[model samples]
Target: MRQYFPSNLKHLCSHYRSISDVCNRLKIHRGQFNRYLAGTSFPTSFNQKRICDFFGVEAHEIALPTDQFLQLISSRTPRPTLAMITAPQRAVEHLRQCSSSRLQDLVGHYHEYAYSISHQGRILCSLVSVKELDGHIVYERVEPSASRSNGSDRTSCYRYEGVAYYLGDRLFLIDYESLATSEINQTILIPSFKTRNARLNGLKMGVTACDHRVPVCSRVVWSSLGTKACGPEAFRKVREYRDDDQELDSDLKARLAKAQIIDGLFRII
Candidate 1:
């Protein structure tokens, strides 16, 4: 038990930045902490509880053999099921299981509009299809073209296909670029279907540049196009809206102005 105790203690301490950091967090003297590490002594019951609480583990950790301890802890962890392997699939599945049935309302086609975070103030627009297939909701976005700044009447087209799901009140769309440009996008949608606001609003974050690339991750606002349109009309709208030569959905415009990115609500990977 003594042999196992010191080895296990060292293993746990190694997780921390340093033995001194762990000792400081434990509020124990450094000398005493080192003695416990050397297997020459052990923590008091009270101190053991403090250590366990700090690490968010049980007090019996010290008695556990290093291997058995790791196995036991790992066994308690929630493992991902097959469906959760992809962010798109996971988002779609989570939305279905979430307490609210509002996810069903989002099933349909929408034209997504947002300003490019990487390109400064330029608008990025695309058409999307969201629907349930078999047992999950899938998201497909098609960006027909990137508008030319010089009004050259020519544009670059692309498509993104992926799965989408919602957590709590927020919806997530994870997509991949068709070419090997290594692009992945995460578009967040907030449900604003109530109170005459038919369009949903959220932020789109992902890789913006391919070669000389902008910052690693860029952020942009995405809102739904109010009414559905056929190919020619939709494509025209996507371009005109880019240069502010066209009108935006009234609800979408209102939502964007009111929305502010909450720093505490976001985290960097």
Candidate 2:
């Protein structure tokens, strides 16, 4: 797979001091850092995390195989049944049609548990938390690495958590949610991005499981005008509507419908 470490090294230089300085702070060998910059070597999960933390970047941003490599690997891996790939793609397409504002809002709220699939076929999903500060949102994802010379890597993913989020900045995966929750304080913020909705839809489409529900104060939906206003019966109605479907529960259906409406409105406006 094509390596992402070189560009990540450039990103590090923009954010930190010389490679030697970064190595010292990460406690990795300077030579290793040089190799990383040259794309001749990759940091173990531990170092990848450390460098990411040091530069305040996501672990996946630095660790995920480059596009060329991912494509190559995916091609080599046996293709899933045609049904498997198409379903997720359709669901993602439905999500993309959502309002930019609501999408931005949802991402800000549940930035942690949100997953984004790009047009380029890259998938970034989160199992972490969202932090809101000074009107800005921060999403973080942490992955464990096998121990290496730099001690284990400690990089994490950070984003705003919505369809509108930048692909490069917002995509990620956490190696272990329990470990991340224990290490950091995870708080649920405002449920604006219909992240709850996306989660629900993901379940319905079989892209994810129904059990992956995130707690929300209430559910909201989009009006015909494509404005994101609160709906009193929307959540309940969603529940009632989905109650009949064998694959989804009333609660999940409600969440998914809310997300779809919001996402649809996002696209309309």
Candidate 3:
């Protein structure tokens, strides 16, 4: 049971950054935790309960044979059995299945441009990659931290992972902040109608990263970079751009301008 516990604990910790990170978050002593991982010792009943609670597992479940434990946890993966899903989950899964074909053509990378949620009057350009995984359409949007000091200090990135669905002539995206897990954002875009140089115009709603976390809505433009443009060179280009930046296309700059609210509707046109 103790041997099984160590393997189960290791599996649970794989989802997190590192053992030290887990120890810090769990408020467990590093040396004692290492002993448990090494199978040289086991936690007391109280400490075992704490570990089980932190990992969202029952005490008995963690002590199961390692093979049985892995199988038990694998059942909770994204591809849950239809019988285990609730009505709402079933409906969402149905929608994803129905819309899978429509998203096949949109599986590529793009440069996402929108008004800076943190910095007024500047446009924030981020890298977005959309792909089909396990019969579902998913996307990842990466934005460089606003506090990057002239590239002197390391630039940490904010990543948002979301699902994409094309429904009723509109493209819809809903994502949460993957790093901090503090916020969710939604974007609705009009699908491209033109054959050449198509840009998806949309509106994004998200809260600012500031202390106040004020909710904001801004016009967003996504320009396709094709499938091969999401590597290092593209990521380096992700950051807020001044209105007068020479590299920004004049048309794109105009499209991202602050438009007036007309009759209670914030129009992107």
Each model's TM-score? 0.53, 0.24, 0.66
Q: Model 1, range 1-269, lDDT digits (tens) per residue?
A: 65777777788677678999888667889999898889888888887776666665676665788899888766787544331246675455555676355666667767776665445656666777777776667767777454543355776667787776656777767899877647788877777756322566666677665476554333334444443444577666554244353476555555445544367554312
1-269: candidate 2 lDDT, tens digit per residue: 33666864666465455666667666788887888888888788787766665554556555555554345434664433212335566455444443233324334222122212111111122232344443333444332221211233433323222222223222211122343232222222223243343432221111121244332222222211122432433222111111234533455334423443454332111
Alpha-carbon shift of residue 224 in model 2 (angstroms): 56
**Which tens-of-lDDT digit does each residue in 1-269 have in candidate 3?**
67798889999889778999989867889999999999999999999887876676789999999999999888865434433456787788878867736667778898899988988878888888998888788999988786652354667888999998988878889999897799999999888766422577789999998899999999999998887765787877788788798989988877777466999988776
Best-performing candidate as measured by TM-score: 3
Q: Who wins the lDDT comparison?
A: 3
lDDT of each: 0.64, 0.37, 0.83
Residue 152's lDDT within candidate 3 is: 42
In model 1, the worst 10-residue window by lDDT is 215-224
lDDT of candidate 1? Answer: 0.64
